[model samples]
Structures are given as C-alpha cells and as structure tokens.
Target chain A: GAGVSQSPSNKVTEKGKDVELRCDPISGHTALYWYRQSLGQGLEFLIYFQGNSAPDKSGLPSDRFSAERTGGSVSTLTIQRTQQEDSAVYLCASSWGRPGSPLHFGNGTRLTVT
Target chain B: GESVGLHLPTLSVQEGDNSIINCAYSNSASDYFIWYKQESGKGPQFIIDIRSNMDKRQGQRVTVLLNKTVKHLSLQIAATQPGDSAVYFCAENSGSNYKLTFGKGTLLTVNP
Candidate 1:
C-alpha cells in the first residue's frame, strides 16, 4: 500500500470481550508502531517494532495488551478481556527504520468497548 | 518518566493571522522533534520537524523552532486558515529510542 493501512475502521464490543486490530504498514517500511488515543487526549505509545528486533513493549498499559509483527511488515494488536476504559482510537504508524525518519500514520481503528 | 507537554491547551486565531503553538520536553537527550496536525476522526498528519542541531526548519506554511537549551519547541503557522483548525501535537525522539513521545496537544481554532 502507498500508506499505512488499518483494518476494521471502527469496532464496538461488550466489556470483557476480546478484540484484535490489524495494521498493514507501508511497503518497505521496517518500523511499525501502535498508539492509543483516548477521547480528547494525547497519544499514548503502546508498542514499537524495528525490523526483526525485539519489540518495545514497555509502553503497553497492561498484560491484556500485546502486539506482534510478522516478517517485519504487518502487525496486530490484541486486547484481551477488554474494559470500558479501552475505548479509544488505535493508531498505527510506519517508518523507514532509520534515524530521523518521519512516521506515516493510518486512519486508525476507533474501538468502543461498551 | 520523560514526557512532552504543551503550555496552552487551546488557542483561537483569526483567519489570516499567524498562529503559534508551544511545547516543552523534559529529556535533554532528545535529538529529533516533529509536529503533527490531527483533525476530527482522522490520524495525525505530519507538519514539520527539526533536529536538535538546528534551531529552526520550515515547511509550506509551517515552521518549527527548537530551543534545546530550554527544551522547548514551537510551531508557527503562517496566515492561519479555517481549514487549519485542528489539534497540534509535538513529539520528541532520541537516538536511543525508536518511539516518539507525544505532547498533550494544543487545539487551534481558526475563526473566520
């Protein structure tokens, strides 16, 4: 794709249900990132992947949050036993995996946990 | 933990006027800074960026100024337009970190 692509532009689920959000990064981009934006709040970093290196999961809010990147390309974020507080916009971004590379973002998936 | 923060929560500017948004970062090691504009229901769009080595950088109608001494960053929009009404965020990244730490953001409203 010419730009980063995210699946299921919007998702709504009952509390305690699990949800999986997918992201397709731009071709040739070796760095991928996931962030959460609460209503009217700043972006909170969730995870980052650089090539085949170990992903930085330090920013994950809890054990219920986890992400994986396959082939250094597409990525998926899974939220287990979702809570109402999980309601927010999930944003995916990709970069060149080099210093000073600007990130290209996807439209994002708005997850509403009722 | 180190973080980026905005000095103002919101600003209202008249159309055709100049708009400035400010940010402060806590980390002195941060080497790269970026500004992003996000509209309602949309992802953040890259505005411009500046490196710690340079004091300023300019884009189409936007300019980014970095003051490493005070760890402050600002974005200036020339001739603000109604379409420029959006939330602006400042992000910082260091050489050792791959993730960009974002600021709370400043809502800029261009009033006609």
Candidate 2:
C-alpha cells in the first residue's frame, strides 16, 4: 500500500470487553509502532517493533495492553478488559527501521469503551 | 514526565503570513528532532527534521531551527495557508534509540 493502513475506523465496545485493532504498514517498512491519543491529548507511545527482535513494550500503559507484529509486516494491538478510560484513538505507524527514517502513519482506529 | 513541550498551546495567524511554533526539550542528549503536522481525523505527517549537528534545515515552505544549547526547536512556515492549519508536534530521538519522544502538540489555526 502507498501508506500505512488500519482496520475498523471506529469501534464501540462495552466496558470490560476486549478489542483488537490491526495495522498494515507500508511495503518494506521494517519498523512498526503503536500510539494512543485520548480526547484532546497528545500521542502516547505504546509499543514498538523492529525486524524480529523483541518489541519494545516499555511504553504500554498496563498489562491489559499488548501488541504483536507478524512476519515483520502486519501488526495487532489487543486491549483486554477495556475501561471507559480506554476511549481514544489508536494510531499505527511504520518506518524503514534505519537511522534518519521517518515514520509513516495510518488514519487510526477510534475506540470508544462505553 | 514529558521531556519536550511547546510554549504555546494554540497559535492564530492570518493566511499568507508567516507562522512560528516553538518547543523546548529537557534532554541534552537528544540528537535528532522532527516536526509533524496532523489534520483533523488523520494521523501525523512528517514536516521536516533537523539533526543535532546542524542548526537548521529547510523543506519547501517549512523550516526547522534547532538550538541545542538552549534545547529549543522551532518550526517556521512561510506564507502559511488555511490548509496548513493543524496540530503540530515535536519529537526527539537520542543516538541509537529509535523510539521518539513526542511533546504535547500546539494547535495552529490559519485565518483567511
């Protein structure tokens, strides 16, 4: 694809439900990342992946949040036991995984936990 | 614990006029800086980037200036247009750490 793509532009789930968001990065991009944005808030880093190395999970807000990148391409972010506070936009981005490579972002998925 | 932040939360400007957004960072070790613009209902798009080794970089109508001594970074938009209205964010990267540290964004509004 010409740009990063995310699935299910919007999702509304009841509190305590689980939600899965998917991302397909640009072709050949070796690095992928996930970020969250609350209403009127800045982007908060969640997780990062480069090649087959273990993802950098330092930014995950809680144990309920986890992500997996398959075959160095598509990625999924799963939020378990979603809380009302989880209502926000989930953004995905990809890069060349090299020095000076800028990240290309997708439109993002807006998750509303009611 | 954000290491980067903007001085203004919102900036208003007339279309065709120049606009400048300012940001400050606390990490002296940060070696790379980038500016991104995000429109409503969309993700952030990279504008321009500047390495710590240099003080300035220009791209089309945008220019990024970095003052590592003061840990300050600013983006200057030339002949700003209504389409340029969006939230601007500054991100920093230090050395081999590929993870970027982003600052709270500044909303830029261009009035026609």
Candidate 3:
C-alpha cells in the first residue's frame, strides 16, 4: 500500500484476554510510531522505533503493553490482560527519519475490552 | 511534566470564513510543531508544521504560526468549507525527541 496499513480494523476481547495489532509501514519509512487515542481525546504516544535502535518505551502506560518491530519493517503492539480502560483506537504512523518530516498514519485498530 | 493544551474545545465557522485554532505548549525546549486534521474513524492527517527557527509556515489553504516566547501555536485555514470540518490537533517535539506531544484537540465545525 502507498500509505501505512493496520490490521484488524476492530477487535473485541474479554477483560483478561490478550490481543495483538499489526502495522505495515510505508515501503522505505525508517521511523515507526504507535499511539493510543481514547474517546474525545488527543493521541497519546506509546512507543517509537527508528532503524535498528532500541524501541523507546517511555510512553507505554503500563507493563502490560509491549511492542516490537521485526526487520524494521512490520510492527506489532500487544496488550496483555486487557482492561476496560484499554478500549481505544491504536494508531500507527511511519516517517522517513528526518528531523521534521511528516508522519503518515493508518486508519487504526479500534480495541474494545468487554 | 510537559503538556500541550488547546484554547478552545470546539469552534463553529460559516463556510468561506477563515478559521483559527490555537495551542499552548509547556515545553520551552520544543523546536518543532505540527498541525493534524482527523476525520471521524480516521487517523490524523498532517496539515502543516513550523519550527522554532521560523515563526510561520504555509501550505495549501493552511498556515501555521509559532510563538516561542509565549509558547503558543496557531493553525489558520483560509476559506473554510464543510469538507474542512474535523478535529484539529497541534503537536510538538523537542530537540532529538522522536516522539511528539499532542494537545487535547479542537473540533472545528464548518457550517454551510
């Protein structure tokens, strides 16, 4: 795809279950980011990955959340023991690793914990 | 302790009128700023950006202004149309910071 792609447009799971969301960045984008957006709120940065550098987890809200990028191409975000508060849209974005380059984002995956 | 905030939560403008959205950042070190437009059920779309070095940057039908002294940022949309209605967000990044801090957002409603 010409832009970033995310899988499982919507997902529903039990409160104690685990779920994984996928993101496929643009062909040559070297920077990837994960963000969470709750209803009527702005985006909250979750994690970032650039090249082979270690992913920045500074924004992850809790230990139950984790993410990884394989070969620096595709990335996955996993949420363990999903709580009702975990319900939100998970957005993925990619950029060219420039200081001020714009990020292209995917539609996002809407997660609902029952 | 860094945060970005919007001056207004919602704004309604008539078609053909110019619209302005404002943001304030608490991080004095922030050097880069961006404006994004998000439609319902879609991710944010980049609109325009301005760096601290320059006070203003312009794009198609849109302009971004930065005020470092007051830590204020504003996005202007010229000749607003109904299609321009969306939630607008302002984001900031400091030197060597890859992650962006976003403002709560302002919903713009362009009425015909």
How large is the interface RMSD of candidate 2?
1.1
Candidate 2 lDDT over residue span B8-110, tens digit each: 9999999999999999999888888989999999999999999899999999999999998899999999999999999999998888678888888999999
Tens digit per residue, CA lDDT, model 2, A1-114: 389999989999999999999999999989999999887788888989996554589989899998888898999999999999999999999999876678888999999999
Question: In terms of DockQ, which candidate is stronger, 1 or 2?
Answer: 1
**Each candidate's DockQ:** 0.76, 0.71, 0.73
Q: Whole-model lDDT, candidate 1?
A: 0.93
What TM-scores result for chain A when each predicted structure is judged separately against the true chain A? 0.95, 0.95, 0.96
- Candidate lDDT scores, in order, read 0.93, 0.91, 0.92
Off by over 4 Å in 1: none
TM-scores for all candidates: the values are 0.97, 0.97, 0.96
Candidate 3 Cα outliers beyond 4 Å, as residue runs: none
Ten-residue segment with the worst summed lDDT in candidate 3 chain A? Answer: A50-59
lDDT (C-alpha) at residue A21 in model 2: 100
TM-score of 2: 0.97
Candidate 1 vs candidate 2: the lDDT winner is 1
Q: How accurate is candidate 3 locally (lDDT)?
A: 0.92
